[model samples]
Target: MNRPADKPLYAVQDIPGKGKGLVATAKIIKGTRILSEQAAIALPFGLPDKERRKIISQQLKTLNNDARNAFLSLQNRFPTKSQYVGIFNTNSLCIKTSTDEGSFVDQAAIFLIASLINHNCENNAQQSWNNNTRRHNIHALRDIQEGEEITLSYVFSLLDRAGRQALLKKSFNFTCSCRLCSLPIRESQRRDGNVQRVAALDEVAKHQRSTAPLQSLQCYHCVLAYHLSKYGREDCEYAQAHGDVATLLVMYGDLARGRYFAQKAASVFRTLLGSDSNEAAEFAAMARDPSRHPQYGFSMKWKTSVDEIPYGLGSADLENWRWERLIPEGIAPFADIPSKEHFVKGGTSKKRHWCFMGEIVKTKLLHPVQLEVKDSGDKKLALHFYSSNTSDTGNSLRPGQYQKGYTVVILDALQYRFEFGCGINQEDLRMMKIFPLRLAKILALNKEVREFSIRHDDGKRKCHGCGAKAAVASMKRCSLCLSFWYCSKECQTAAWTTKAHKTDCKSLRDPDLRGLFFYNWDEAQDSISFPLQVADDSC
Candidate 1:
């Protein structure tokens, strides 16, 4: 039991069910790099049986007395008698599937220090491959308290109590008894349901092609956005999430969204796994310049430069930026539709973004059957006039229509009772509305409204310090204020000196400010006012 001077930080001791494990000496802060050691013995990936034996045998010959003793002390859970096999079984960790292509085999050089760290279905540390250093690194994903075992997850997905037990028995060979794995049957069932839902979403998210009930960006967000509020585990899963999204976007030929999601994934992985990790490095490179990607310029549908990130949007707005769902399409923007409103009570489905936009091809009037005859897709639909639009000719509406184009906003496609009567069928009035303009003309007018009414730019790049629209790629915003960019030294100087951007810049650079630019406010449940502070930048 000879432990190092960092005594209270960690000590080698027997762990119940999981052999000799390292117990926390003192509280370990999340994101703190725990240890970094050179590999004592290393070999090329996927060696033949004879070659693997030769490599391990050669490495054993070079070990000093102390190193040999350390190697001998690891827990060997395997039913093997050979010391060589025992050490290999005891000191091994999962070789990443991404880096080491094959089955879930163990890396032989995983040190005693690394191997002594135990497993928990819900772990406090994240382990990742740092390809640059050809070493593995562990960072505290959440704070680990003193006297607690520093644990990491062996499997990728968040499993339920039953799922976790099964995986442990089949793969890592242990029955978990962690707090999360030991809830009461009912409570455990609820937690398991949540885990299963999250896992199901993750699986659907990763392999969307194979999953049924296919979803779009809007649909995925509708289902998974609630997970942020529901699970702490999802916070660590952002990298995987962004990667899945990036993959989906790429397949759809939307490089703009693909690049954005890839960049976001890269950022999250870099934070959790370190920038040198393959996931971080690959994504970071993709984010830097999307054109370099093999699929770049594959389609011009959603084209935008990487530096086109907005200057002053709120958190939800920034999320829209990251997702590329803010762009206009045939349907209403995803940000404009609320998921709760899309589904009825007891899980009945309501039409999403279904609104009637038609032109008045003809008009007929008769008491009750008073139809404002209109052209809906070149077919005449009976729009029984029901509004209290009091007129001199109350029931005698004419053939010459009052307007050429008319618009209608319909809520749930429900039929209601008609109080005013003229023998008009209530169903006819139920599906129709008259808002004076055709759908095509309405959309044109909407574009003009966006153009002339709003004083802001088209969410393009401008010097943060000065109100100058600089070239997108060449501008860099002040890191602190983030609200403004500078084209060059002169512009940055002007911002810092003459414009008083120094103060404004600092205020705008706040994470809350950044968060504002990230969150979507159009279909928001809660009103997000100005001076938005950053809550957490997980998105």
Candidate 2:
């Protein structure tokens, strides 16, 4: 019956549509702990309804006259007031079930402060049942302006506007007009579809089992996308979603991505829920080393030691690192190569792979300055061209006549700090192509090549020289290129001597050229220009 001595923010007056609610007296920043109190009365679970009623009635009688009268004055939604149990049932929150030990079979606490909080479709506060504390607590998820009613959601899962309205009307005895409740039907449906798809995708990921390390990266991507989208940020769902992603990543061996996700989740939780809360502490531990978790290295595909986190990632890059995927139109050239330092050195060749892609916005043939202009599919790429035709008079292309929207591949690229015409391919014309589309679409084709066409392992290879299926280990590699391996020395000799491997070998040996076969270019980061650089032997 006792209210916190701190003056009530709002007078305990009847809230017209809603039973009785508390309005904020001043703006409350997120993560502010509003109130914490011990329960005045506790009852256990599952006695007969009649017996439970008798117990609550007897307990009420023990309170002082003023406290008893104040307790009885609380609002009731149920139509009938004759039953003492009905009034308690209408106002009391379910604190703990009977399984946990308490005085009564089922324990319910009457929280004077918590019960005053209102419900809203677009709530800025999140309420949690903290079993550790044995009390319900509410934390602000966003800034709550003075005089605004502080509301929390009643439903366990996020409900769409219509679904929320239906549930609220039935259980809470009020219609909600919060921002979510007022969204346009079409926009509302679109956002709802995203939410539903995210849930469905989680189930799909769970149902499909995998034994490899990092095997769940594909599934985690679905949840990651949903949390990053605009709608997910509006609610506390983003933090919870990131926490789920971090947990799954850590279960595998991807401490790099897992730690990044956990840090992100922890940040959000620190904002929506107090930093000292259990959820925040859990994520903080995960952010240190995802692999240190109990489930670390459970799968082999994504295995990484605690020390394997990458170094060069910036703040923005850390975010992209968590997801580690490219948007459909992002410009990324090094998408296919293995990121681990040991793999490139141990597996096959010292050379690392990469490809350059550019959209030909203009073309003009003016001999030595045969200008075939291009774009990096992004404005940030700084689309300027410097000619290295190397002759007084070489063939120039006609403006807008030759392939306009095309990508040109530069082989064995080196950084030329001299000018914009940096990746000077000695044999530029031979490998470059005008694909009649955007650079993004051209990269999509390369993605298909990596996913559907190329074989990754040297142990299992399909020869590009003769189209023969052979184990890479036994095969004799071309002396000049080392890119094409043959079944026998005879096959190798034949490839170089009889087939056109002599020409192909030279092209394949070029590190930039070899990269076209290895990287997962479908996942892009920032804008990539024509002619990607091949990493040095050490990378």
Backbone clashes under 3 angstroms, per model:
32, 29
Best by lDDT, which number?
2
As a TM-score, model 1 comes out at 0.56
| Candidate 1 to native Cα RMSD, angstroms | 18.6
For model 2, what is the alpha-carbon lDDT of residue 180? 74
- Scored by CA lDDT, what does every candidate get? 0.55, 0.55
- RMSD of every candidate to native, in Å, equals 18.6, 11.6
lDDT of 1 by residue, 1-539 (tens): 11113434667789877778877778877566665555666555566646766777788778898877777776666554466654664456665433455344345565658778888767887776554576667777778898888888776546677777887776545677877778789988977766676667565655543332134454455334544544444444757667666655555455666777787788777667766677777887776666677655444545555566566756655564554442222223212322332222221121122233335544465454344433334544444554454463433334343454544433222222234421123232333334444656545533432332222445445553456664556766566544455678788887678866565455444453344333333332332223333343222
49: Cα error in model 1, Å: 9.2
Best candidate (score: TM-score) = 2
How well is each residue in 57-137 modelled by candidate 2, as lDDT tens digits? Answer: 788787778767766776666555345555555556555433445432336666666666677656777765455565566
